[model samples]
Target: MPLKQFISGVAEFSANEVLQLDSEYQTYLQPLSGKSLALTLLPIEQTIQLQFTDSRIDILLPNNRADDVGSEIGSEVDSDCHLTIQLSALSQLRDTNQLTTLIKQDKLDIKGDLSVAQHLSALVNGLDLDLTEILTNKIGDVPAHSIMGTASAVVNYVKYVKQHFDITLGEALIEEKQLVASPLALANFSDEVTDTRYWCDRLAARLAILEKKQLAGDK
Candidate 1:
């Protein structure tokens, strides 16, 4: 299924059913107080605007940019940080099942401020949104295969992000991999990699020039 369609369907279902279980879903929003997240879906070239507040949740989807999708879900808690997620690889995450497979394959590429990403992952992992039950009741048929197979994969991704990035949902940083907390470090590494590639090309060009010069001298 296309990512946009899948996300739209999920959003529709979530809007109706999630509101009914407001108290239950509120737990997931606890980490968002005063936080903002920019979620970019690379494949679809779409972005979702999210603002996490203690009392209200505002999700702006591509189709409805002027309106918020889920706005009546939470209460004012505490404002602390911001997170940005570039879903450059796992655009399939729009489907819960595909998200599981991508995570298992280690194909999801998430880059951002490590601390913020980690915290967001933790919040998502801690959510008790029993999607199976919700879908079964809401859609009248649960996507059992997709949900069960992908649940652990999704959880593992969160764990990996938390551990590797040093940030958890509650603003807690894991002790290990703290070095990744600096986004500049990642940028520097990327720059070095790019530089190495440039130098390799330069050497190849130099070798070609020397070979041509030798051929000319022989002539």
Candidate 2:
């Protein structure tokens, strides 16, 4: 099948599903006041760009495979550096929802800003697309590497922070690792991981708040 046809089919499949997903996302972010998240689904292997402005978020959905979807959120008065998530291997993960999940989980290599990647990761996970079921029905047996590799990457990132920055951000970061690795692990752990969805929501909220505060302080 042609890429366009495939993408169209995927979009059709996700259209109704995305509404529920977005609602779940909003519910997950209920604690965050005055913040909005925009999600854009595009053709395979397209770049997902993000910009920060004042008061509103601008999300440009990719109209064609070659086109890029640029998204930005913040205030118009003062903005932070624009972040971009380029999907170089989008086509590879396009046909298989499992592969997409693997990429989001960091099982596949993501070459870009890690912080932005993490934020995108959280955003993708928050989507209520029922990817798990899709993967199970289409592609039986989830790859163990998908979760393990992501867990390892998070672990390494945490270690790097501790060794270089010497700033303690607490267990939330670690809990993120666990949640991505095995969301069920959250139930086992008494820490912040207990609320896997909340962890991602809080991370995005705190990051936005911190970014806004830093911009303010700079002014």
Candidate 3:
């Protein structure tokens, strides 16, 4: 698939899932609710707006892009806090879900309403939870524990093999093909050869002069 097709405008994706995700968030955050804030998210290029209230969360997408303008909040809205982050950063958050980590690394930029931004990061951090705990409710505790352990081991084994292959390929290329070398070592070898030739020429000339002097003295 093309890069654009594969990464189909984050704003559009979020707008579709906003209802479901907001419902889950609301269950957790029952108290202290209102039009909490109007959030503006700029994923490097595309812009998305999120408005939080006691009732529900509204998602706003771009107007120019026909593809992303389907939801009610797709229209223009006032931004309470503006955040700029790369599309790749959002992808990373899918696994880690620690917005503070990105903020610490300077991968995410926030402006306007510092408190609101910090709250948003906390909301995102809440996404990271133990899957085993949720699964145990549906299945038995022992089964859920076994499943998670097996899944984790599989992921680790795949990662280990990938890492081992990368290191092996790099070493093979350097040692067998001689693809990499030190420029300083080559220069040192050249300089030593030149010095040896100069010394040998000087010694040969001195020996010739001594032999000629001895011949003259004998005559």
Candidate 4:
């Protein structure tokens, strides 16, 4: 739950920072101001809600801060977008912007409208936030930028390593250990099933024709 807590805190902070920015920046998030998004993380079995208000984005963790906002766990409140994904794959989705590709690869599953996710992406990308200026009062501009850069690099490297590790482990299991079927094997099996069904359907149709002709001859 520490990661969930950190994510919530970051959302809150980002919302506050966006509010303090100029009106032009607010326009980027206007489309999402009244919508809600839910992210269901795999393995952890947690759903985090991002409730968008006109002022800020409230990140609600079930049985946690959600109670503060009068939200219930598994509530009837509909989300504009609900994404079910691996917790580890979140950064890849963000950094790569390959939502459709990920879905095709079975790396992500989405419910509800995709336009909502697009709007959310727009909100993130359109905001050219300069955090250095915000922190310059407390620390010098050079130090602020340096810290932000180092943090960004560290995050990217960690994500890169995690992604590669998952891929390597999957390969080892499928190719080396024979513990799992590869994607190509799955596709081939699907094709074989389809072909078998086609032949069965054709045979059934021919049998029906023969039965009808025999009845006609008997009559």
Shift of residue 206 alpha carbon in model 3, Å: 32
- Residues 105-152, candidate 3: write the lDDT tens digits: 877776667555555555665644557877787698999999999999
How many backbone collisions does model 4 have? 0
Better of 2 and 4 by TM-score: 4
Per-residue lDDT for 7 in model 2?
A: 59
After superposition, the stretches of candidate 2 with alpha carbons farther than 4 Å from their true spots are 1-19, 27-58, 61-87, 91-116, 130-219
Query: Tens-digit lDDT track for model 2 on 98-129?
Result: 54565576545433333443444454556666
Per residue, candidate 4 scores C-alpha lDDT tens digits across 1-219 of 588689789878977776666446667667888888988777675788788876677888755354457654345436888888877778876754677787887778988877777877877777765666766666888898899899899999999999999999999999999899999999999999999999999999999999999999999
Off by over 4 Å in 3: 1-44, 54-58, 65-75, 85-111, 180-219
Question: Per-residue lDDT for 122-218 in model 1, tens only?
Answer: 5545556666676666555547657766887999999998786654532343235453345566689999999999999999999999999999999
TM-scores, all candidates, are 0.33, 0.23, 0.51, 0.51
Clashing pairs in 4: none
Better of 3 and 4 by lDDT: 4
TM-score of candidate 2 on Cα atoms, chains taken together: 0.23
- State the lDDT at 53 in candidate 3: 60
Best by TM-score: 3
RMSD to the hidden true structure, all candidates: 18.2, 22.9, 12.4, 9.2
User: What is the alpha-carbon lDDT for the whole of candidate 4?
Assistant: 0.79
